[model samples]
Target: MSNSGWTSIAETNIGTVRKVNEDDFLDLPEAQLWCVADGMGGHAKGDVASQLITKTLSDLASNAPEELSVDSICDCIKQTNYTLIELSNQHNSIVGSTVVALFFTAEHAHLIWAGDSRIYRLRSNTLERVTRDHSQVEDMIDAGLISPEEAETHPKANVITRAVGAAVELDLDVKTLPLEDGDQFLLCSDGLNKVMNDLELEHALKTMDTKTISNRLIEIALNRKARDNVTVIVVRNEKQIEEALHETLPLDDTLPLHYSNKS
Candidate 1:
């Protein structure tokens, strides 16, 4: 990791044993945005839906509003839902996907999600999940019908309670957090969490760099014979805000006071 200007690197693999790739990733430079979408409608339509969502989001981030707020991101996702729904109707197919996105700016990060794709933050060797799953099993756990451990093995664990293109309207979950040096974030699909426990994921992320951790995590899921698509995006903050700008400054020019870059 370079200690200047939000220098982050991410690597993704399709996993050793998946016949169809229903996962898509978006890495945009302007806002340092990283996203993962896992499609779940069925067959070829699933891949198409995920790809469409990713492309829509990439476009929105590229031309994001001046005050890149959570509401703006939610609106972008809603627009994506409409696009997916329209495409599905045009092709006479049902298509939907779960999205997890992280928008990294100079000083903070914003997260948005729908369905089960998740985001986790790693700091001081500890990992904390940042997004809640919109699934039946999650609802059950929240309602106290079952413990978190039981939800892991529940047959309905794969069923999502909310998703893009599932209905006329979509509700997005969003959160924001401040960034710190050496902090790392992970965005992953259900395939990674379904088989690998939180402790295992934490250890893997803490010990490995972005590329190796991503590859090994996918390997673990494939070894467990995960039935769904798997994907992961890791972001590590390597420099302080001031240090980053100073490192990239032109020798005779003054740095811009407002470094509000959105993705």
Candidate 2:
């Protein structure tokens, strides 16, 4: 409820099944960046992997907020990937995480992700998924082997093909969009989306502000007995905050800063 620059709130829960909440997030509004990372299931020290991803970008953002941009964040994630691989080798187990980050610059919102974690943008009562999931089911859908609805309940729904520490080399996707008035963004792990569909999410984003949308999203997921670790981060482009920060660029002028399918 504070009138500030790009307000954000994050929530995480262990859910009804998992004993450990192997999910972590970064909510640094002052740096105009927020992220959600879900630890790889069936992997050891998953919580450690998720924490490391957030901590790595957090350190860079804290030390140099002005330098926080798409390139810098991607570099930090790649660096974290190497760190997690080393940690996994030392533990003799696979330790990895799925990361989705939202970085806000003066005129655009930059997004980067790997695995099934996602970022969604709601503008003018319409919802648009910003990042395509890097998962087995998603691939099936791409190949016309499965319908979107079937993919939801597919046995392999939880099987993600890409993650930070799973391979010697890391692959990440980057996208950018112009900032718009009343544009609200949702960053979450698969737990939230698995239980609630796009219609429910659109309803929440259309009617509520950032904080309310965040609480309500988690409340609904927990009510549905979210079986996996649940985490959500809701952010909005507040006009007052934008003016305070001097990012008064007209909407028409804001365009995708850069594009990369994978890196």
Candidate 3:
């Protein structure tokens, strides 16, 4: 997707080991929204939860895109959470998913996330995570119980502390930040980050364009034998590039800088 202010793209894979792609993503640049969801539970239930989110948001985009806002999006997600919980109860099984989404408008970006699915930003040639994981190891990290490197290989690394349907009440994390001219964002499932570290992610984003960044990241994940489904969305704010071009443009000699009034 390309517009005057943003250029964005998304990609996903079942991964080398997973039989089913338990991950799904929503990309509607027309509404200036994009999301990555990682479903959990058995195939049917997991698919149900994630796809439900995708469809719900898709319908909202189609029906009232002009009305989309952070609060409105959150309201829709909360409704989906309630529906997922009811479905899980009726089926006597667990059905849940992690969600990470980005919404941009008016040179500002709003982020919403839960569980380990993440959003990161690359600004001023530096990459940093925008959303923290809602997972067991993250709790441990906060308590000073485990190093991130240790947590990566820990037995409970995959154990998430929160998801849409994990509990009756869903508390989403939200952040709003002003967008810079060269700002870029990466939203993805745990699959991609599980195999690559932050340094690797930064390196890729620093060097790759929006068109190929997602594919390159997925390829890196596959090379490392990603165990879970992977999904990646890369968005670049082209406003900075446009400004740079305008600033550096050579002035035409035909344009006069001084008047003959002095004579």
Cα lDDT for residue 152, model 2? 78
lDDT of 2 by residue, 87-199 (tens): 88998898999999998776788899999999999876789998999999999999999999889778998999999998889989999888876678999999898887777
The lDDT leader among the candidates is 2
Worst 10 residues of 3 by lDDT: 254-263
Question: Relative to the unseen true structure, what is the C-alpha lDDT of residue 44 in candidate 2, on a scale of 0 to 100?
Answer: 96
Question: How should the candidates be ordered by TM-score, best one leading?
Answer: 3, 2, 1
lDDT of 2 at 77: 95
Error of 1 at 158 (Å): 0.8
**CA lDDT, candidate 3, residue 172:** 94
TM-scores, in order shown?
A: 0.81, 0.88, 0.88
Native-to-model Cα distance after best TM-score fit, residue 26 in candidate 1, in Å? 0.9
Whole-model lDDT per candidate: 0.73, 0.83, 0.81
lDDT of 3: 0.81
Q: How many residue pairs clash in each candidate?
A: 1, 0, 0
Pairs clashing within candidate 1: 31-263
Q: Assess candidate 2 and give its TM-score to the true structure.
A: 0.88
lDDT of 3 by residue, 56-93 (tens): 98888889988889998898888999999999889888
